[model samples]
Target: MKHSRILSRATAALALAGAAGTAAAHPGHAASLADGLTHPFLGLDHLLAMVAVGLWSARALPAQQRWQGPAVFVAALLAAALASLGGVSLPGVELSIAASVVLCGALVAGAREIPARAGLALVGATALFHGLAHGAEAPMGGFGGFAAFALGFTASTAALHLAGLWLAARLQRLPALAWSFIGAAVGTGGLALLAARL
Candidate 1:
């Protein structure tokens, strides 16, 4: 429990540092940089999905398996970056991202005890979609600014994952139905985003 708390605090601090870096990188467009940095956090569909990654990781494995979760996440980020650089055209990326939130949340709520390798596979696949979206949407002209934004966003993601870990630890005590409701909420938000796009 103490370890979890420490991790959570560290994640939050990293998030703040990433945001600061982004701000520093774009001095003339502080507002823009802030907005860019926050773009990933604003939408419920996005935030929930990212958090769900962590939650799913925690619930799907023992404490010893924790490292795989972050590793898969980083791998996904790298894959997405590569895809973006390669100019892959993913038409429904935003909607797919929204759906990932729902899917990952459901996986967590179900408390599925997947093998570490399977969990990594699932996360890596999802990361590709997310990474592509992030890469495609990145600003073209300001590499420094974009780098800062990416750093902040990545930090925020890690923090949310930590939060998810904390939440999952607590939720383990709750009824399964209650957990299902959490999944339903996440799914509902994703569906709403999908609806909006359509």
Candidate 2:
């Protein structure tokens, strides 16, 4: 694609991101499909990590199996969220989540350096942590409510992954410096988030 098209897409994506309603990490807010849809965009950690997963997959995986990364992540996220609803929980979840952003950003930076299987494993593990965090803040209603919220968030997360993939596709023509800058910004944001949590 031409630079103009790429820049247009980027601008549109940024506009949408800016326009979305923001949710706090672990807000403990009421759960609904709407809330769930907006949940992934609530925190930069979640947004950045989720998008980075897509970006890494685009850079690291063969075209034939590129979808696996997002598939595994979505599956793990849903499964983990369900597990949380079943009264299971993990400790140190917040810190792990923050670290996931850092790791994901790094993964995107050096996606080709890691083996594909290793990358998938890492992405899956990161999704698990994210799922646990999302589950922890599920709505207080019965399973029905949780189900709605889960559906909403799952859809949104998948969309974000697609957005990342699209962005990565555009990045293919850009110079290495562009990738490095993106990775650095993402990693630095994660670090800031991690420090705040500490």
Candidate 3:
């Protein structure tokens, strides 16, 4: 019953986000709080990577350390976004973000094989690129506007991660092979997006 409720909520959230409109590669559609909240949903790469982080966390880490993955990712994401505001830059942001999807998905698929700390590190590192991409694309604004956007973005991102974690929990009933297949699918999707960008 609890599992069903969690799944239902996650599905509802994804459905609502999917209804938000077309997904694009950082078109800078709008810089408002709404945009920040919805921006991660607007991009396939961001959505996949964020969710995969949660999935990987739940799959690989012990229950006690599960929060570390999301914490590291969110911190890195915010740091990179803030750094970009200060004129810091990372080359090939789009490519890296795409790669994050692929790598994160792969991690989910093979969560048992990798060490927990290594997985956490990879998540944090890739998040930097995501942060840079989001930061770079966001329009210039005063501190107030940026702060609002950041708050919304951060909240939305954490929600997505929770969704992934919930999904992982629900999937525990499934065979390991099934979980691996899902991860492979996500990785394949990332590859397709990467090819499009390249």
Ranking the candidates on TM-score from highest down gives 3, 2, 1
Q: Write the per-residue lDDT of candidate 1 for residues 153-192, one digit (tens) a residue.
A: 6776677778778767765655566555665655565565
Ranking by lDDT: 3, 2, 1
CA lDDT of each candidate? 0.62, 0.79, 0.79
TM-score of each: 0.74, 0.86, 0.86
Better of 1 and 3 by TM-score: 3
Query: Measured by TM-score, how close is model 1 to the native structure?
Result: 0.74
Give the range of the ten consecutive residues with the poorest summed lDDT in model 3. 13-22
Give the lDDT of residue 169 in candidate 1. 77
lDDT of 2 by residue, 1-198 (tens): 576566556534533442342334677764699999989878877888888888888888998887988999999999888888888898888888878878887887778788999999999999998898888888887899998999999999999899889888977776655565566556666776676677
Stronger candidate by lDDT (1 vs 3): 3
Cα displacement (angstroms), candidate 2, residue 196, comes to 0.4
Write down the RMSD of candidate 1 (Cα, Å). 8.0
RMSD of each: 8.0, 3.8, 4.3
